[model samples]
Target: MMKIVADENIPLLHNFFSDIGPIETFPGRELNAQNVGDADILLVRSVTNVDEGLLKNSNVKFVGTCTIGMDHIDTEYLQQNNIAFASAPGCNATSVVEYVVSALSSLTESNGLNLEKIRVGVVGCGNVGSRVVETLKRLGIDVCCNDPLIDQTGLVSFDEILSCDVITLHTPLTKDGPYPTHHMFNDEVLSRLKEEQILINTGRGAVVDGRALKHKLQKQPSFTAVLDVWESEPAIDIELANLVTIGTPHIAGYSLDGKVAGTEMIYQAMCRHFGLPSRHKAAQFIPSPPLSKLYFTSEAELSWSMHTAIRACYDVRHDHYALMSSLSGTEVQRSQAFDQLRKSYRPRREFSTIKVLLKNTDSSMHSQFKALGFNVKSA
Candidate 1:
């Protein structure tokens, strides 16, 4: 059997790759050359930094990250060493989209704001942002999209995005190149935000300056912020976490479906690299969700019913609560707790997993629910 070293948090690894390999699991951050020395396959998440130093002495012929972002992986080193690398792009996109929707529903409900009335600005129009734009428009939300890489007609400028009622970021973290996203939202951009405007960051933490955000929240009381990914993640800024309206430990793309999809993506890639027949599928390992279906009453309001169904499958508040409880120790302890929380995160199902049966609802209502990614059916 092939020798494989993989990150421990990657779900269903053995189920997918066991027939081909003997897998040894390690914490992503702690996965060093020593752990990968004798392995022909190395799999990791965004936490592990793949570089020459780590792989120069190892037998790792293939490297894969089960996450969308590639900033953590050194593609140059892999190219130079002839080590094949694969990353699961858009694997967890729907999960992130659902996270934003849940946060939107939860935030709007708490703040007494109407979802359809608000204009949301999505910074990146890639896999995740595109889905967000489509979903929001399905709900009749006014949306503005900005992507430096893509030149589409509907794309708006970043300045235009600044004026939106809610700004959701989905850009990747890049330091070099023409369009750098590191510290994209500094004091100047943050100062432009209004007191009541909502800011949600599920893209990357450093995309918005943490210190600047903290200062902004401190000086401006009512400026609402929702953060899932932080700048110096694991070792995140606790003060900033406390200031945000909702804080989750980089789990926006952590739905069980998403993670499994990611694993399957890389598994297929590895199989292709080795010229092996792919025998396993992700759906085979996935079972029915705990929340199978939801019933709507004749008296249920459209918006209220939508929010109820969304929250029943996923509530950002639950993640926020879990994260808040882990924030009580020293910086080191808190940092460790943050990573632990992500590793042992509860299995969250996607919006599509929950079946919504509508009663006495219009066609538009059913269509909207489907657009929002729920498995909707007329009762």
Candidate 2:
């Protein structure tokens, strides 16, 4: 039997993997040299620090993280030690894209920002960034991209992104490199930003300088932020929590489909490593419910209808604004509360899960719903 050690935080995985091996799980903080020494395979989420200290004397041969980001794992050390590892990437692209769309539409309505003329700069052209670009383009907005890795194909530079009306970051975290993203958005970078610009970060928290961000928000309170990830994470900055517009524990990729995909990917990796037959199966996703067959003849009713449909997926700005309002008195309790709230959040269906039923006639409304990822069908 393969001796496996996994992170304690993942839900429903212990039971799923129980039959495979005698697995021992440790909370990320509990992992140390003494405890991890005997394991041959290690499975983890983003929290556990898999480095030389933890694996210096271990017999670990394989590492698997059920998360999109692999910054926590020491890739150089792993390669030097001849250990193989796999991570689930692009697993939550659609889920995060839907989150961004719902939040943007809702914020436009509430903040009175005109969406038609806005320019959005998306940093990182990987899976998540590409999806956000596609959604923004479909809505007829100008979306610029900045990814050094990708060849220039309608891509813009990092300096150009600073001038955009809205900027969202989706880059991975690297502590040391020629382009170190650890604390990439420092005081100097924040000072260069337009006072009215909106910033969003769903990538690693260290990607943006938290203290600098708080200072910037203080100087220009009108500038907004939608932060799904933070610098210290569960040990997030309390005072800074009050500064940004949106706040959530790093659960941007926590959609049901994303979580399921992560599990399936890890399972497949384990199967291949152990030379075991795959027990993985595809999800039988229930088809989206059809939209209302009754036509909304009135323009007022039509707006409400569209609003409700988007809200079902998620409203990104609402959470940010709520955290901002509460962080004044609640900053000390912010991290724990944030984690609890995320753990208890109800399931949110994605845009692809919803279908639209068209009635006789309005071409504009029909086209709009179809554009929003609703499968339109004649009633």
Candidate 3:
């Protein structure tokens, strides 16, 4: 049997990979060359940095991360060493989208902003950004996208993105090239953001200059910032944390379905690398969701009903509150608490897990709910 060293936080490991090997679980941060030296396969999450130091002397031939981002992995070294690598791209796309929706819903409710009237600018129209655009459009909201990597015929420019009523970033972290995303929203861009705009960053933390953002927030204090990913995370800026509208511990993609799907994707990749059949399936290992169904009466407002169902599946406020409360401690303690929060994050199901019953659903309402990934049933 292949020896597989994996991050303990990865869910449903035994259910999906027990037959393939003898698995050793280690805290992602604690995984090192010493523990991984004997393994033929290595699995990790974003917390575990897979680089030359960790893999130079290890026998591990395959590496997989159960997260969407690849910034944590040293792909060049893996390629040079001929070690196979795989990452679950778009696995958590829906999870992140649901997070954005929930956050926006809460924000609009608290501020009494009309959801349909607000214009949203989505940066990085990849898996997550595209889904966000689709969701917003389905709800009859005005949305514009900006992605330099792809065709920009109908898309807006970065300058235009900054001027929108709300801006959400989903780009990967890249430091080099013609259009680098490192501090993409620096002082210049952030300075242009007006008081009415809501800024959200669920992408890489460094994509926005945290110091610049802090300065902007302190000086202006106009825009609402919702940040899930932060620069210098764990040891993130506590003062800045207090300033944002919502600050979460990078748990936007921590939904149960997304995490399980990530594991399954990597398992399949490893099987292909080893020339073995992938018999394990995500559905087989998934447990019943805590919230199975929700009912909405005909008299209920469509927006209210949708928000209720979305929150029923996953509420961003719980995560926001948890992160905010963790700041009431020493800096080191806050950092430790941040990591602990992620380690012990409660399982959250995606919107797809719940069935929505509408007492009087119109065609438009049904289409909207379906687009939002809910199972809608009409009374």
Best candidate, lDDT: 1
Q: What is the lDDT of candidate 3?
A: 0.90
The TM-score, computed over Cα atoms with residue i paired to residue i, of candidate 3 is 0.97
On the 0 to 100 scale, the lDDT of residue 128 in model 1 is: 93
After superposition, candidate 1 runs with Cα above 4 Å error: none
Rank ordering of all candidates by lDDT, starting from the highest? 1, 3, 2
lDDT of each: 0.92, 0.75, 0.90
lDDT of 1 by residue, 1-379 (tens): 7899999999999999899879999988899889899999999998898998789888889999999999888899999899999999999999999999999989877787788689999999999999899988988899989998997898988999999999999999999999999999999999999998999999988999999999999998678999999988889988988988899999999999999999999999999999999999998999889999999867888878888888889999999999999989798999899999998998899988888898888888888888988888888
Better of 2 and 3 by lDDT: 3
Worst 10 residues of 1 by lDDT: 107-116
lDDT (Cα, tens digit) per residue for candidate 2, span 31-85: 7878779988888888789999989989998888888888889989999999888
Candidate 3, pairs of clashing residues: none
lDDT of 2: 0.75
Name model 2 segments beyond 4 Å from true: 282-304, 317-334, 361-367
